[model samples]
Target: MNIFSRRARLGNAWAVNVRLRIAQGKIATIASAAEPQAGDVVVDTLLPALANLHSHSFQRAMAGMTEYRAQDRESFWTWRTLMYRFLDHLSPDHIAAIAALTFMEMQKAGYAAVGEFHYVHHQPGGQAYDNPAELSLQIIQAAALTGIGLTHLPVLYTYGGLQAQPLAGGQLRFGNSVDAFCDIVSLSEKAMAALPADTCIGIAPHSLRATSESDLRQALDLHAGMPVHMHIAEQTKEVEEVAAMRGARPVEWVLGQCEVNEQWCLIHATHMTESETAALAKSGAVAGLCPITEANLGDGIFNGASYVAHGGTFGIGSDS
Candidate 1:
């Protein structure tokens, strides 16, 4: 396919009458300052598509449902309570439909790919479906339908809190033993085979508050050479909880424990100290920022200027 743009951003500079040749599913060649050719798909402006580094597609369905304040002080925790209630009524089919719409919207908004941090597994009552990866397969199918490059991240969520609390209510659907979670990842891998070669699977430990140190280690060891994602320091309450139990803040503790590198993407590293920000910036891992969701939930602003000044890498995501 040939694409010609009257004005196009090529790398860091904009060029007039730029032409692009797409072969298979990738841009094969770029000819800047070129004339329009026959049968060229012409456009006014063109730019590179982005990748949504973190998302929970299922929550896209709950877009307007959680906007209003239902408590004395509306917060991320209060919003989470409503989210859990909302997910308790969703089935695999509902997940697939919602994911399809979400992926479609992402594409329409110039996102060529998404890293779906999917954690909702099993039925509402916490029973394993006939197919353990039923929800994973549904997400894969939705990506296939939308033709979005999917980095399917199956999240390992074991506990309810930082202190290894038992799972209850909506948390049950996300709970799985380390072995069971590994099996689900394997099954999800097989299901992803039907999609494009770029459609791949990664693992997420949910968060330090949701999984134990041992389980996080096991999960990390299981997926070598693949992307590893985790939620860290999204809320002050979560930071306090993790610090009280682990003796360090979420980002600080994970940096101390894990060999964080380019493959790791920490979502919502919102609350970080000067030392933590500097350490994370030097760690070579990507900070996944979800500004809209953070603002909606009243999560604090990320230390973007300082992190960028330290040469840290970051990406945006529609986390909701």
Candidate 2:
């Protein structure tokens, strides 16, 4: 058992001489405005822990590697090309080590949990491993070792771009059929069963560009009742391409085609019109914003003022 006395925030007010009783690694009870015992540990301040709702932990190694002038006109697409090259050589051991170090740093920074949007599933040559969940289990092991809560989102990345284009270049490793994707999710769920009680397994359709409407529906059905996440409308080019192909913006298409609600998180809804923004806000989905990554990639600013005014929910992420 653990006991501590500190000045703690209770909802909108602060309470002094608050005592917390921790048992079985959880807070068993809390007492407000109470005197401390002789053996109590006193602290001057306390704060609630934060959750990083989006992360690609393996990308931490490539943080400063792409800061130089690679092209005459550097952009998100250019940076992505560099990232693809970087991941082309990362072994499972490398992924695990990087993820463990990243999760440890997050814990030190007061993060209680993380949502990992994992996509790399195959080997360097785009061959499936003997076990489909091999790479996913590596990430799960990293989370278990670091004592951080996990929400593992196994991504379904079938195509390279709009119109169901074939996977090319570094995108080869993330490709899988819808049936194969379901098997991976099932195996990943079993692999995560030994983890802490709070660990979650979810579905991620990389984006509208990477998945078709049918594939998206199948993935959602495969992991029904779980939190669903996707990258949406992060770039102007993406918005334009989606509009050109589907005759609708990305957000508009998703909101109309799917039943997005509280269990959904649309990451980087950065490029949206006023109507799209208001419509998504009414859908009760969380906006997964990553300001640091957005600024680094030169993605446009999210309409936070309008979104929050419409009673939209939001959560921050380290989308690296």
Candidate 3:
């Protein structure tokens, strides 16, 4: 059973004295102008919850540690070096602990669900664990422990740069061939079977620079038309790189190459031309915005006013 009040911003605008009868863990009925009776539970206030559309749960462990200004010109690239170092030492146990605490914090912050864009798949030396989904299972367990909805988006990261460079240094952990990535996806789906029914699985091609055109096609074909996400135009360098490598802008190349509809979410689409912005808005894909992280990373502001004017869809996340 549940109840809501307009005074607490918890109920529909038209609802008064709202009550919900839950059955089988689902709301069976909603009634307004209802009165509490024998054995009824009540709260003075309640609030609606939101979904965190993008997250790197393990990075929650290194939150305040990366703020130090070690270099004269620190940017996203430099911040990533610290991130790589932090993840280099994480065992499955560490991942679980960090994820559990982070998920608990998200729950406390009123996030009912989280879309984890998980990429740490291999051991420190880039060796696959006996279970390919070892880190993924840890994330799932964390979500299960906290009762937070999980939308697991396993990231496919293959190349080092726009020129299809080989994975170098710390990136080895995130590299997987098409066949190996498919195996991991299959294993992740099986691992989630014992999880809550609301748990979902999605694919994330790490970014235009990390994936080739053929690789993107393979990822999408393997996805079977589920929710697809990609990191696009997060940095100006990335936009320039895609243009130099692909002869078109990142969003432009994607819109021409893929069937981007409501099932697609372009994360960190911070840099775009007016035409690209309008085209993306007309494409019906969501712009997954991480406002806090964008600010922290010095990523530019999104064209929110224009995008919203064109009926673009978007969702919020704390992209750690």
Candidate 4:
């Protein structure tokens, strides 16, 4: 029995007449009508919301907090230094508070879900918490508290490069060998059970700057059927470094070695050759473009005009 029915105009050219027969929490049916039943409640219009394809919830606290212009070269790398410093002061409770604040803003801005690229997974001093996935679990808690759909991408960051060098100082808390990292990833899945069961768990390799061949392979293999997101070719220096270490460019090398498909999201692939761009489009992965953040960080524009011309599927991200 429909309690309410009403004709509603949707967007600029669609008339949606909703007859909501609610039972529990599900929508029973929608039909064309303009009648109000006893105790009926009618609405105007409804539509599916957007998903924030990438986010660093902890970074929300540091937003507009890094505006000072240093005498030295001010770049994303420099900004990253400040980001690391900010994380040092973030306790689990503080992280959740920050996430809650940001997620509330996201919801107000029409984002229904957030794919949190959570890599900050330990104490400030790089020690594991009582639960190895404590920081990640905090993010899940924040999303639940704020009523945001959660997509947890626990990052597996190992090695400084192909050389497997020690992690840089700021990257200390992000360290985990392949085995330990995968175990923590599994733990993150357990953490998700406390959230919406529809939550998706994916793997983030951090970047080519943070992983080796064997390390990336293990993360990908353990991903089951989840999407794989990574930072690739964001900076010119990164592209040169990856090429110097391997024989090919970052994305080219990755597509050659890894099994990439629609189940992948490449974040900030801001630098690429024509071949790389064409090949990536052919792979069917969504490009996670953070236009506002890229402009803020002076990370250069993605050749979006060209990528879309090539029939690429892209989704926007608020990766603060």
Give the root-mean-square deviation of each candidate in angstroms: 2.1, 1.9, 2.4, 3.4
Task: Order candidates by TM-score, high to low.
Answer: 2, 1, 3, 4
- What are the runs in model 2 whose C-alpha is more than 4 Å off? 1-17
| Candidate 4: C-alpha lDDT | 0.82
Ranking by lDDT: 1, 2, 3, 4
Predicted candidate 4 versus true structure: per-residue lDDT over 141-195, tens digit per residue? 8888888888889898877666788877668789888787887778878877777
Instruction: Kindly list the per-residue Cα lDDT of model 2 for residues 1-320, writing each as its tens digit.
Output: 54555688877788888888887878788888888788777788766688899999989999998877766898899899989999999999999999999999999988999999999999986899899888999999999999999999999999989989999878988999999888888898999999878799888899999999888998888678988999999999989999999899999999998889999999999998999899989999999999998998889999999998998889999888
- Across residues 10-117, which tens digit of lDDT does each residue of candidate 1 receive? 778888988999999778899988999899999999988899999999999999998877667888887888899999999888999999999999999999999999
C-alpha displacement of 6 in model 2, angstroms?
5.4
Off by over 4 Å in 4: 1-46
lDDT of 3 by residue, 1-320 (tens): 65444333445554456666777867677666778655556756445678899999888989898776777899999998888888898999999999999889998999989989989899987899999888888988888888898999998999988888998767878989878888888888888888887799998899999998998898898787788888999899999988988899999999999999999999999998988899999999999999988998889999998999999999998899
lDDT of 1: 0.93
- lDDT measured at residue 216 in model 4 versus the true structure, 0 to 100: 83
Find the candidate with the highest TM-score and give its number: 2
**Residue 37 lDDT in candidate 1:** 87
